[model samples]
Target: MKYAVIRFPGSNCDWDMYYVLRDQLKVEPIFVDYRETNLPIDVVAVIVPGGFSYGDYLRSGAIARFAPIMEDIKKFAEAGNPVLGVCNGFQILTEAHLLPGGLRKNQHLEFICQQQDLFVQNNQTTFSNQFKPGEKVMMPVAHGDGNYYCDDVTLQQLRTHNQIVLTYSKNPNGSVADIAGIVNEQGNVMGMMPHPERASELVLGGTDGLRLFQSVVTRQLQK
Candidate 1:
C-alpha cells in the first residue's frame, strides 16, 4: 500500500510522519512536494501531517490549502482513498472542503501542548476502525487553532450521522460539542486536531496513535 505525505513550506512534521511509516510501520511513504502538479498513481493513501504550514500566515492552513498538490489530493480522496489530516492538516482539510467546519483559535487564545485523552466515537470509519467505540486513547496535541466550530444544526447532523470520530475526554480547546475529530460523509477522509503520528512509537510515550495507521493498513488489506 502506497502512501503520500504532503509537504508545504513550513510543514515540520513530514519527516516524523515519514519515519513512522518507513521505520515503524515498514511502509514506504512518498514525500510529495506541495507544488507538485501530478501525484503518483499508486498512491493509495495521503496524510496531511502537522506543522505551521506557511507559518500560519493568514490563518492556519488557509494558504496551504491552495497548494498545487491539493488538486491531486482532492482527486485521490474523491476516489475513495483514505486521507488523514492531522493538526494543521486538519485545518487544511476543512479549508479544502474535504471536511466540514473550521478550526478557530482556542477560546483561551493560547498555544496548548500536552497529552490528551480522546474518546473514540465511531469505529466504522477506516481511520478509527481499530478502536472500539468509547475507547479512550492518549495522544499529544500542540496547537492554538484547534477549536472546532460549526452551526448548531450542522453539529447535530454530524452527531446523528456518526460523523464525529473522536471527542476530547475533557474540553481542552473549547470546541463545540467537544469534537476532537471527524470524518467525511464517505468515511475515506478524516480530520483531527490531535497528533496521531507523534504518538505512533513507544518512545513517544504511548502507542495510542499506532492503531490509527494500523487500521488503515488493516482495512486496505481486507479490501
Candidate 2:
C-alpha cells in the first residue's frame, strides 16, 4: 500500500517514518511537502510523523496546522482515509481539529523521552485492528506537550464513541485518564504521542508497532 509522510520545515521524524515504511515494511512512502495543497489520490494512508513543526514556537503544531498540505490531509481524513499522527503530529491533528481534545505541557514541566507501555483501548479501528482489546505494547515516547485534556462531557462522548485508541499503561505524561492516543469519530484518523514507527523493527527495539502499519496495508489490499 502507498503511504504518504508529510514533512514540514522542522519535522524531524519524516525520514524515520519513511525508512520504517520503505526499508522495514518494504513500502515506498510518498514524500509530501507541507506546502503541497494536493495529495496523491492513490495513496492508501497518510502519516504525520513527529518533530517540532514550526520549531514548536508558540505551541506545538499551532502554526504547522495551517500548512497547505493539511487541507488535503483533513479532506482525506474526513472521507475516511486512514491517517496516523505521532508526537507533534498528534498535536497537529488536535490543532487542525481533525481529532478531539488538546495537548498541553506535562504537569511536571519537562520534556520526556522513554520507552513506554500503551494499552490497546480500541482494537476495532484499522489502526489497532491486530491487537486484542486490553493488550499492552511497548513504544517509545518523546515530547513535552504530551498531556491530553478534554472536558468531562467530551470525555464521556469519546468513551461512548470508542474514540480512545491507546491509553498509557503507566500514566507517563499525566494525560487525562492516561489517554495516550485517540481516534476520530469515524475511526479514520488517529493521533498518538508514542512513536510506533520507531518500534517496527526487532533490531532497533521491538516489533510491536509493525502490526499498526501492516494492518492498513493489509486492509487496503483486501479492498
Give the clash count for model 1.
0
The predictions' CA RMSDs to the true structure, in order, are: 0.8, 1.0
Alpha carbon deviation, residue 133, candidate 1 (Å): 1.2
Candidate that scores best on lDDT: 1
Q: Write the per-residue lDDT of candidate 1 for residues 1-223, one digit (tens) a residue.
A: 7789999999999998998888878887999999999889888799999999999999999999899999989999899999999999999999999999999999999999999999999998899889998999999999999999999888988988889999999989999999999998889999999998889888889999989998998888899
Give the 10-residue window scoring lowest on summed lDDT in candidate 1. 19-28
Q: Please state the error at residue 107 of candidate 2 in Å.
A: 1.0
Model 1's TM-score against the true structure:
0.98
lDDT of 1 at 12: 90
| lDDT, residue 37, model 1 | 92
Q: Once model 1 is optimally superposed onto the true structure by TM-score, how far is the C-alpha of residue 44 displaced, in angstroms?
A: 0.7
Can you write out model 2's per-residue Cα lDDT over 39-105, one digit (the tens) per residue? Answer: 9988889999999999999999999999999999988988889899999999999999999899999
